[model samples]
Target: MKTRKAKEQIVKELKEKFEKASLVILTNFDGMTVAESNKLRRSLKEVGAEYKVVKNTLMRYAYPGTPVEQIKDAFTGPTGIVFAFDDIVAAAKALKEFFEEKDSKLKFKAAVVEGKVADVEMIKQLASLPGREELLGQLAFTLKYPVNAVAWSLDNLFQKLVTVLENVKAEKESA
Candidate 1:
């Protein structure tokens, strides 16, 4: 029962969300209660994701010209949208955990990640991946490990040369 002005405002907000999100997930909240949805929202918020149960029409309006527009056809049924601006894996993990914990009625409808339409299985796979910080830490280790090893190797070679020089000096002094 929203007026035209209110609906327009909502569409505008959705547009902004779509612009910012790197991961856009659509879900069907067919049997979920208000309390359950709010709990899910809180869980998503902890990981910096926004969740909204949107009217398909408004979502469709917001979708066109946006990266998530590729999945506009998925806006059927009780569509719930999750917008993850950063750390898509963390958001996916939060959602998957909530789904597992409550055995909730949330069903994955579709996903558009990084401007590409992705399969529902992608969400599952993303959930299994480590968070952004962990991935960055792992990448840093991978990038720097060889450099550290080379530095250590050089230091070890120098130590051996120094030891050999010392041994030669000792031999010469004795002779």
Candidate 2:
């Protein structure tokens, strides 16, 4: 049995986490082996997320008076939460990939992002998004395309002018 002070500390930590996390995913980790769970933790760590098992009661205590209260009921049955404070999409994508590759029984129950409770379909969509670096690179390329096009157009115009001058010189010589 946990002492009152210990429970309070845990609740305090959980409440702080709930307030700060950008994304919170609840999952049912019923049949996953310890090794598989560890692997999932490592994968989440790679993307700067954390995975931990929490008691339903404790979760309720932590979430009371917070935006996370909406997901308090989903804390039932072998609940493990992945909290992403850095990159929400990366955390979801990494967890989804790990679950897919391992074929483990870890099932996503619900997710909350930016204080809004997200359904399963929304969670899947979030998971489908490319990682942070990839998205940044894509945005950068998109922003750079117009600049590149203008540069190419200028180069083509200069080439045309040179070509016209060369043709004029050729005509004079031929004449």
Best by lDDT: 1
List per-prediction Cα lDDT, in the order shown: 0.90, 0.89
Instruction: Please identify model 2 stretches exceeding 4 Å from their true place.
Output: 101-103
Worst 10-residue lDDT window for candidate 1 reads: 95-104
Pairs that collide in candidate 1 are none
Clashes of 2: 0
Best by TM-score: 2
- Residues 1-175 of candidate 2 have per-residue lDDT tens digits of 9999998999999999999998998999999999999999999998899998978888888988777888877888889999999899998888878767747788988888989999877877888878799989999999999999999999999999999999999999999
CA lDDT, candidate 1, residue 70: 81
lDDT value for candidate 2? 0.89
Q: Where does candidate 2 have its weakest 10-residue lDDT segment?
A: 95-104
**Clash count per candidate:** 0, 0
